[model samples]
Target: MIRIELDEAALGATRIAMSPLRDAFCAAHLQLPGRAPSWPYQEWAGHARAVWREDDRLRPLWELFTEGPPGVSDFLMPRPLGTPDVYEELDQLRATDPAFVRAQVAVCYPGMGEEPFLRPYLTDPQAACAALADAYAAWWEEAIAPCWPVMRRLVEDEVLLRARTFATEGVDALFGGLESRARWERPVLELTKYIDAEYAAGERRLVLVPLVFAEGCRLYSTDDPEVLAVSFQARGAAALRERTPGPADGGDRLGLLLGRGRAAVLRELAGPLTTAGLADRLGLAPSTVSEHLSLLAGAGVVTRHRVGRSVYYQLTDTGRSLLALLAGEGVLGTAAA
Candidate 1:
């Protein structure tokens, strides 16, 4: 159990951020054990197999990242943030001192004499950091950037929900909403983990990052014991499996009831998605998807959020109820269930 002692400012400062790098690190778990069954993991597993099948340069890092090891490097995941700025984090990695990087590596992999791959980092930390940054960015571009739109919506929506909870249900409910492993007791926010430790959160910031790939609530802290970082399972995580098609229970009938294209749009929206995303997902023309979206919006079956030039859409309560009924009839997928 890790207990974080929160001050007034720490409590108020708690916020959510999207960490692409953090997600990448979490993806390393694919090489190890304890990976849960999810559509996202299944898709990621395919990608990892294809990417590392050949004698790729990333294969070494992939091997090193396997679980049951003493340690995995933490320099990649800097601090928790209330933003999804990957470039900013890469810049921080570039500016990190060689000694600090080496020190962290040493602490994580204490018996490094046998681990030859990590020797370069110990010998020349600057080059190691540069290499790590490059590797992380390359992996993100290949693995995560393509699906970021869906991933971003999942993280952002959870933050919004938590913010509303904090406002309406007060601080206790806010912590309760984080994860089943976390609970609030007065000044102490306890996280039940394999390890037991505590941090005194004085006049510092406590950043709560909701990561789509995080297996459980984990802690990261700054030099000042008062400042800490907590990354937990984001809400709607199951939706990350957006790439995997849900059960086509009564999809045909639903499509017949609502024109095929419109029904396809609604089915794809088992999770939040954009118009273009819907079109690509359904292999339909963007115009076709847009037209269906317009009709759905007008009919009060979906709600739209226009952010700049892009509009994200989700099922309205009525839409959800409709899907639920269809699901019960075994017409649609598990999305409604």
Candidate 2:
């Protein structure tokens, strides 16, 4: 069990951010020997395995990933500042300070820096950082980038749901509902892990990152006094591998009620998505998606929020109730009464 002590300030500083780099690393970690199967990303793992088998260039990266411990070094998987672009994260990895890299490598690997696979990182941290960045870029492009849109939506939805929980239900409820593997008791959040450890979150930030590939919770903290990052499995990960059922299929009652295209739009809004994202997913023009979104917004079935230059639309409570009723899950007794 690992116990992290959070003061009022630390608790107040807690926030959630999405990390593509962390997801990529977690995906690689999932491929390690003897790890339990992740059904949600099984198909993706098969393709990634084939790439790993055929590509000689990834061998170095693979060695580094598997060499030291059960987890990746915290330096390589820095806590994301916001919704990070993976390419920018690669650049950040490439530009990591040599001294900082060496310090973290020493802590993660301990006395094994002279080994053939680990020597480059300890001897020339800058070159090693660049090489690792190159390896990650190649792996990302080949294995993870194609499926990123769906994965991003899953994480965004998790964040939105948790944020609402924190806002309305207070911190205890928020942490209490995070996952079964974690237990919340006031200022201390206990995590189930293979080892016993303790951390005091003195004035640093605490970040909660949702991983599409995570099977359980993992905690990451560094000696450098940065943020403490906790990653947990996100909801609806199976959708990552499953095919999106076509809205026009005769079995979809929602399609019959709303036009097929509009119903498809509503279903996709289970997670927040931008207009262009919805268009690409549904194979419709952006103009058509915008018109559908406008009507849905006017009807109070969906709501839109502007984040920077992009507008994201998600289902309202009414929209969820409508879906539940159409799917035969909502109880009509209360309404009739």
Candidate 3:
């Protein structure tokens, strides 16, 4: 659970610029999808605002940053936003209310005294705000909205899965050692290939990286699909046993319990095998077999596809990496790394 602190000004600057980028993207394509509210933008902004409002430690820093961009320096905050709901809802909003387009700007950045800069547009303030919407609408129809469906599919199915694995292992185990400055830092880039086979399908246009940060010295966060696993590590606790030399040792503590176990199971099931087939071969309960398969699949150790009712599993090209790592080999080969 690595959490990065963000510069509010940086985020505000980013938020202030988001509409232009979105519009410019749509404009470059030139289709005009019609007037519809963009929920993704709204929610993304909402999250920025939420963090500004909610997170105590980050709030002051963020506020100071938003107060002045130069003061922030080059605050390389992570590009992560909110959950899938943010994107999904944004898409839906765009489809439903074209007028809500300006909401994108208003949601993230604070206006004078709880009033957003977009408030005037909401109440008939005109000019640039309206122009932004019109331009964005054109762009959406031409490029974004059309490609959105498929883009969404990949995010929901694939991105979500890898995020789940990271959520489970990254923080819960990583921090068991001690706290560091990594918390309240910017989110790390989620290597697309690592996220899902069909990763970043549409991200060629927009950068999709994780935001990381720490809370002082004790906690960190890397947002995921469900709950953002913030400060979930067991810092200050007795040190756990070091991971034995194996593929599982690549990551932190959870990797040993999780990575090693999955590696051991997948090692046996390198060849094609059904769930029951695997359970029988491993001599473990069927339920235990299922759990290992889930983790291994997440780690890309194996692939699974439903054949009728029973799902069969096999090693992916990537799974070879896991196996190699476990064998004390380097990435992509069977040589001690």
| TM-scores for all predictions | 0.71, 0.79, 0.28
lDDT of each residue in 45-76, candidate 3, tens digit only: 23233333444443223332344222111111
Model 3 spans > 4 angstroms off: 1-131, 172-301, 305-318, 321-337
| Residue clash pairs of candidate 2 | none
Model 1 has how many clashing residue pairs?
A: 6
- The residue-by-residue lDDT of candidate 2 on 1-337, one tens digit each, is 8888899888888998888888888777766777755667777778887776677767668888677776557667765755648888877888888888888878888888888888888898888888888888878888889888777867776787677667766788779878888999988999898878888868467788888877722546545466778888877677656455574557789878888788888877655678876775676789999999999899998898887687888878888787777755442221210
Q: How displaced is residue 117 in candidate 3, in Å? A: 12
CA lDDT, every model vs. true structure: 0.66, 0.76, 0.35
Worst ten in a row by lDDT for model 2 = 328-337
Name model 2 segments beyond 4 Å from true.
35-37, 156-169, 201-203, 216-219, 242-299, 324-337
Over 143-185, each residue of candidate 1 has an lDDT whose tens digit, in order, gives 6777676667667656655665677677887786577878888
